[model samples]
Each structure stands twice: as structure tokens, then as C-alpha cells.
Target chain A: MNKYIQDTHAHVLIWLEEAANMIRESFTEQLIIETKSNFSDLVTNMDKSVQNFFIQKIMEYYPTHQILGEESAEQFKDTNREHVWVIDPIDGTANFVKQQDHFCILISYYENDIGKLGYIYDVMNKNLYYAIENAGVFLNNSKLPTPPAISLQEGLVSIDVRNWYGKASLERLATEAFDIRYFGCGGIDSIHVITGKFAAFAASIAGPWDIAAQRIFAKELGLCVSKFDGSDVNYLKGGNWVISNKAAYEDLLTIVKEF
Target chain B: MNKYIQDTHAHVLIWLEEAANMIRESFTEQLIIETKSNFSDLVTNMDKSVQNFFIQKIMEYYPTHQILGEESAEQFKDTNREHVWVIDPIDGTANFVKQQDHFCILISYYENDIGKLGYIYDVMNKNLYYAIENAGVFLNNSKLPTPPAISLQEGLVSIDVRNWYGKASLERLATEAFDIRYFGCGGIDSIHVITGKFAAFAASIAGPWDIAAQRIFAKELGLCVSKFDGSDVNYLKGGNWVISNKAAYEDLLTIVKEF
Candidate 1:
């Protein structure tokens, strides 16, 4: 019944919220900061702790549900699975280490490889953004309205700082926008896009755990989410993604195509 | 007596705080956005409102004190008065208009043509940074300790956003530092420099009202505040100013000397 599905979703949402809180508390303590591929690339012990928290919670609730997370599943190399839970324990490790308050915990539940429910929690603000497919998105238990359709020229855009320096695709978009901000957190950026604070967000590199929850919530809010080439986002792959209100997304694509 | 001067400073501080509250409330109602020179050159109704509020308070308490403010001081071009009060009612007008929270209220009082007191209120955080010359600095009544000396290589640098894209001096410093931030407020930038949150701050176009109080406070804390060319700062003109801890300031000037 519809009631059963809703109840199940609510239960999972509560569990995820609790898990996120655990991660945030651990983050408040010292984090074991570690460099990834380069000086700019960073990961932390809190990332693993949060991921394990979610993984353990899922194992206890639904043993059959597969789990994928940034820290533990980086070795998996593939994520095409049914009834899977995708997680990014800490989405902005760089910002976290720097004591910047723009990071968040992101999680998405997939049924047969299709996103069924999504959740993104901004820990600093203590706001949770969540959505079920075909149901409306909610921010901190309040239903969120669809963002107004704003244009590239009239709206603020969020650009990845890495892209602004030299990435041609990002630079091209930057030139066409009124203003750009780099808050150093992907989930926080997507939340702004969905809330109309930012008209669009473009990032050249992100993993499944980074965009999955925001992608589902954004779509439910009548926003567009896609790869840079205007293709459907492959949630399992590390690739460029752009999310925006309808008009601005198309305008951004036009510039991206020209580039 | 010291008590009389202290009482006068306290009285002005309380009045300014009230005016700041009024400005914040009015700004929240509606921004009334406008431009100064170009699209990037921004101003707002809140700027004038805050200025008027302070001017009225100054007139009511001490009509003999000459007032100079960013939004309403075009008529008073000469700042040679014996008891001139320089004010930037809202120091970060762009940030205010854009609904960003890093703006401040800057007030500098001169007695007999000599700097007497300066107060910079970070409105959003409610942290009031103030100093009377030779009396040391305080953040909301607690005396602030002198920040430790740090070099540009290991420190975070705060720069004006305009300098980032337009000049070789900023670009060179940006390349040498670990990171750079542009919070879009001169008073806040200078405060951060004095507090050790930033190793250095350099802006090319800040008026006397913006740096007068902060410069005195920085000097009292054993930090350096001077023109970029290592000359004494003239408070009557808008020009390049660099504030930093001792080691960083000397190192930055050495680099500027080459250019």
C-alpha cells in the first residue's frame, strides 16, 4: 500500500538523519586529514567513520540492500546495483578541514538502479533536504516550492573553484554569468540551486555519492540535472554535472556547446 | 579625566549599536539596490540609512563633532577639522545589497586632529572590535592579544576581489600564498589580518573611513599598517593599504619593492 511505502521511507529518512548526526559529531573532534591524489585532493578519517556508520545501519535494517560509499567503495570500481544505498559521508573534506561550514552528508536510495529517495543534510545549518520520486522535496520538514525560473544573467551561479582557474568548460560559463561563488561544498551548492539562491551549479568532477541525493531532490523540485553534454546523468560515474532551473540550464548548455 | 573619555566612547558605542540594529532591520525589509560606477560597483539604500542614523545621533549628542561618511560626506571634502568623525556607515555595501552577512559599521573619532578612537562592528556576528589610541584593542570588551607573526607562504591572505583579476601585485601574492579569500569587506579583512586569521590584507581603494580605526588598532597590536609602497598612510585619501603581522608585512613589501 502507499501507506506502507511512505512509512518505510520515513523510517529510512530518520535513520539517515541520525547517521548524519553521528558523522557530524565525529567531525567536531579531530579528523585524520589525508591527501588523496594531489595537494588539493583531500580525505579524512571522519569520512570513513560516517560511511561505516551508514553501512552498519543499513546492514542492520536491510541486509540484502547493497551499500556504496566514497571511502569504502572507492575500490569497488562499479556501482550498477539494485536496491543500493549510495553515500558520501562528508561531501566537502577540504572545507571541513579548513573549518568552513559549507559541507554536508549526502545519501540516495535506489530501487532497481533507479533513484527512489534522496537526502542531503547541511550539518552546519542543521537542515535536511529530502525527496521521494514523484513526491515533493522538503527542507527541514517544510515542503519546498519549485524554484522560480531565472536566467543566467539574473541569477547567481556556483562554480567549482578548480574550474575557474583553468577549466575551459567552467571558465566559459563564468564569463556568461552575472556572478559566481565557490563555497567548496557540492551538496551545499546543490541546495542553493534548488532553493533559488543560485540559478545554476556546474562541476567538472564528482562521484555518485556526491551528486546522487541532490540530483534526485533537484529533479523533484522541477530543476534540470544532467551531464555537461546534455545527456542523462550516470549516477555511478565520475563526470561533469550541471544542475539549474530550466531556462538557465539551457542557456548554460548553449555556452558549453559553443566552448 | 580617563573616566570622561571612557564614558563618551561608551555612549557613542551604545548609540552606534542601536543605529546598526535599525540599519539591519531596514535592510531586511528590502535592499533598494543600486550601482555606483558599473554593474560591479554596488551601493544600497541601507548605506544611506545607516549613515543618516549615525549622523543624527552624532548631532544629537555632540553637534560640534564634524562628521564624514561614505554615503553623505561629498560636501565635506576637507577632513582637517579638530574633532572630525569618519564613518563608513555600512562598509560592505555590495555584500549588504546581496544579502551577504560579512559587512560592518566603521566609525573613527579624532580629537584635536589626532586619532582618538576607532570601532568596527561586525554586524552579523555582533562582535565589536574597538580601540582608543595607546589603550590597546578589544573585541566586545575582552582585550585582544597581539597576533603571532606569520609569513605569506604559510598564511591565508585576504585580498580585494578587484585586485585578484586586475593587477600583478595581487596575482603574485596569490601565487605565493597557501590560499586567498575575498569576503568583500575591507573592515572585516583588516580585522582578520589583525586577529591572525589572515597573514596579510592589501586593498587598493579603501577610504580613510574604512581603515582609520583598524589601522590604529593594528599598530597597537604590533601589526603593520601602511601604504603598499611602505610609506606612512595618509588618512585623508583613498589609496592602497596593506595590513599584516610584522614578518609578513616586511616580506610583502620586499616583493612589492621589486614591482
Candidate 2:
């Protein structure tokens, strides 16, 4: 049993390293940029290329792992596989095209419906955040210390403005926080929450590929991750989610629930 | 007259460079960050440091030249001065404090009530944009070419959302653009418009110092610089201003007037 777990994590790490290399090369090539739903929904050819690279690498090693990726996933498909790999090749496509630096590659691995490993790589900064459940999170070889518990009034939260305008949960959360920031990137926002750069991050409509990896690392860092209704996150479902430092989590959940 | 113009530009350049150096040094030293009215109203001790840096430099080198700055300027008590220097020491304070690096240093020179030279320094990138009226604008050392004319529906416009929410003119302008972006820096927005990175930029409230330098540069690049109502910009007063590529300027004003 011990050998199986170690082998799985080691294989995932090798794939992650290869993915990171592909990302770095594509970024330097000045990839073609395009729009998705609106001008704000920026997508680049690099996104697809990176996803293809990872999908190929995963197939070569873990052929049976069910693959779900942001650029290729169909919304309604049901893949209830015991081992699934979810990926967001380029999480901040807008920032990737415009700023060329504030984006990341995210990967989550689940085994027997339990999160086995999570990885988020900030491509430009060359910082990699990863964790295995019950094992501590690490930021590029250094184990990240658990952030100090902070309340809403003392913490800054990263929120997507679209969610704020569409739902009452965001406005309620805003009134209780010290400040709110929006950088238009899910992976970066998730990193901020776990690293203490933000007290919490609340967003709606994020996919499983988007939050699954970060959620695992955030949990290992002693944060509370939940759906808007204060329920455990279902890795197969995509919906509203909030991750916060422990002290602010209950209060945030209460405000979100009232909405 | 040519010698006088050269002398004036040279003097302003030296002083501006000195001020820029001070800004870079203070930022590297890790200045304290603070907020003004709200979290959005970001300010830092470095703002005052840079402002004072320019103010002292201006007085020391050109004592006869009038000085105006965001932090130190009162109402234009001497509006008819033959020579006036307008400065915004550190633009985009919020981005700077947030470690986002999109801020700039701005300075403008006017002689006998006419713009003589305009300089906007993008500090993070270390690129300086400047123009002498009738002499043409330049990004760093290269002369800037005029951008292709585009209409409101075909171009990106930069705006300050805070200003749009507060002003009727801006609200109307906001609804007429293909897309809008808010980076919270007057000088940065103006330079982007002048360089065609953004087709137009409209903000309801900016001091003369904020627009003085960029206005001359935009005009040299075939951009229209005026108040929202298509009236001339009065450097002695603070009001709404729009800088745009020619076609966009005309098309936008028509839409804005209807609003």
C-alpha cells in the first residue's frame, strides 16, 4: 500500500515537471491570443498546446486516469472513474495574453474519490505549489507554514467582480472584509488565499479543473474550503466555492448562506 | 528662440531624471503603504517622497518656473505664468503597492500658456515617452508613428470605473465603447492611448498636470484631446477629458452627446 501511494505521487511529480517546461517554452514563443465568450474571456493557442502536452504525457504513463481539461472538457459528460486527472492548462488566460506573467498551470489527482495530489505552477515566477492529502503543502521545495488565523476585518479577499454583480453572496462577504481585490485569475487567487496574501477567495462558476488542485493544497495549509452553502466540495461538481483562513471561514460561510 | 526651447527641455529632462531615480530608490527600500478614502485610494510614503523630490528639484533648477503636483498643488493661483511645470510623482499607487508594476512618472512643461514639452515615464519598464509640440512624440528614443484611425466599436478604451460611476458624461461614454479597462493611473492610460495600445481613454476628473504632457503627445500622434463635450481642455481647471484616435474621438463624441 505504501509503495503504491509513493509511486503515484512520484509519477505525478514527473508529469508536472514536463508540463512546466512546456509552459515556459510556449510563453517565450509569443503565442497567438484569442477571445472566448467576450473580450475578457481571453484564450491563447498556448492554452491548447499546453493541455495537449499534458494530456499526451498523462496518457503515456497513467493511461487509465480519466482526463478532464478546461480547454477540452464538455460540460455534461459523466466520468465517475476511480482515478481522474483534472487540469487547467492556463488558468489566467487574460493575464497570460496581456501581462504575460500572472497565469498558472493547475493539476489535481483523485484516487478512489479522495484527492491524492494537487499542483499549481506560477509559470512566470517559476514557483510551484504542491501537496498530498495529510502531507504538508510546499512552495518550490520549502514547506509552507500554516498561515496565522485571521478574521474578515483583518484580511483581504480576492473576488471576481462578475460573481459580485450576479450574486448577493459577494456583496455580503465584501462588507465583512478589510478589502477586496480582483486580478482575473483563479489559480493566482487560490495561491493568494493559501499564502496569506488574501484572507479568502470567493467565486462562482469555477470548474472542478480550476479549483480542485488549489483546494487540496489550501486544505493542507489549514484553510477551510467549502461551497457557498458551507458543504464539502465535490471534486466532480463545478459550482460556487470559498476558501478562507480558519477564523474567517465560519463568518464568511454565514454571510454567503444568508445570500 | 531655438536655443531657449532646447535649454528649457534639457533642464526639465535632468530634473525629471533625478526625480525618477529617487522614486526607484524609495520603492526598493520598501516604503509604507496606506489607503486614503477607501482601499482603492491607495497611497504610500513614497508618493510624498517623490513629489518633494521633484518640487525641490524644480525650484532649485528653475525657480522662476511655476510648479504643480498632485500632493502639493493648491488651486492654480497664478494661472497666467509664462512657464509652469506639472508633475504627478507616482501614478498608479494602487498597482505599485499591490506589487503590480504598471505605474509611471509624469511631467509637463508649458511656456507662455502653450505646451512646450510633455514627458511620461513608465517607471517599471524604464521607458520614457515625450513630445515637443509640433516636434512629434517619441517612445524612448524612437519617434512614434500615428496609430490607424478606429471607431468606438472597433477599439479598446481605458477608463476609470470610479469616475464613470460618479459622472454622467463618463457613464454615457462607458456604454459606447467596444470594451473598457481600468488601470487607475492617469499618465499610464494617456500613454496607452497615445501609443495605440488603447484607442481612447476618458476620465471625469484629472488635474491639468495629469493631462498636460500627454495631451501634447497625443495630438502629435493624430489623437484628439478634449473634454467629453468636445470642448477645449482648460489647463487652469480640473474636469473630464478624453484622448482618442481621430475616428474614435469623433464617433465617440457623437454617441456621448446623445447620452
User: Candidate 2: where is the Cα deviation over 4 Å?
Assistant: A1-44, A75-82, A94-103, A112-159, A162-181, A188-202, A220-225, A229-235, A242-259, B1-43, B98-102, B122-159, B162-181, B188-204, B242-259
TM-score of chain A of each: 0.91, 0.90
Model 2 steric clash pairs? none
Candidate 1: residue A144 lDDT (0-100): 93
For all candidates in order, the CA lDDT equals 0.74, 0.74
Tens-place lDDT per residue, model 1, B1-259, is 2775687798878877897787767744866778786664677777887788888888887887788788776756464587788889888775565435668999988776567788989898788998888888889999999887777775666665433343455456646664565456888878877777678877767788877777778767988888878998876666878888787877788755543
lDDT per residue for candidate 2 within B1-259, as digits (tens), equals 3777788778867776777777777755867877776755667888888888777877887877788787777734564679887887888776565543667888887887688788998887788888988888887779988877767765667665432323344444545565555455788777767766567877767777778887778767878988878998877565778888888888777755542
Candidate 1 off by > 4 Å: A1-30, A77-80, A166-176, A254-259, B27-30, B79-81, B100-102, B110-120, B124-163, B166-176, B187-210, B220-235, B240-259
lDDT by residue for model 1 (A82-170), tens: 67788898898765655435678888887776778888888877888888888889988899999878788766666554333433554
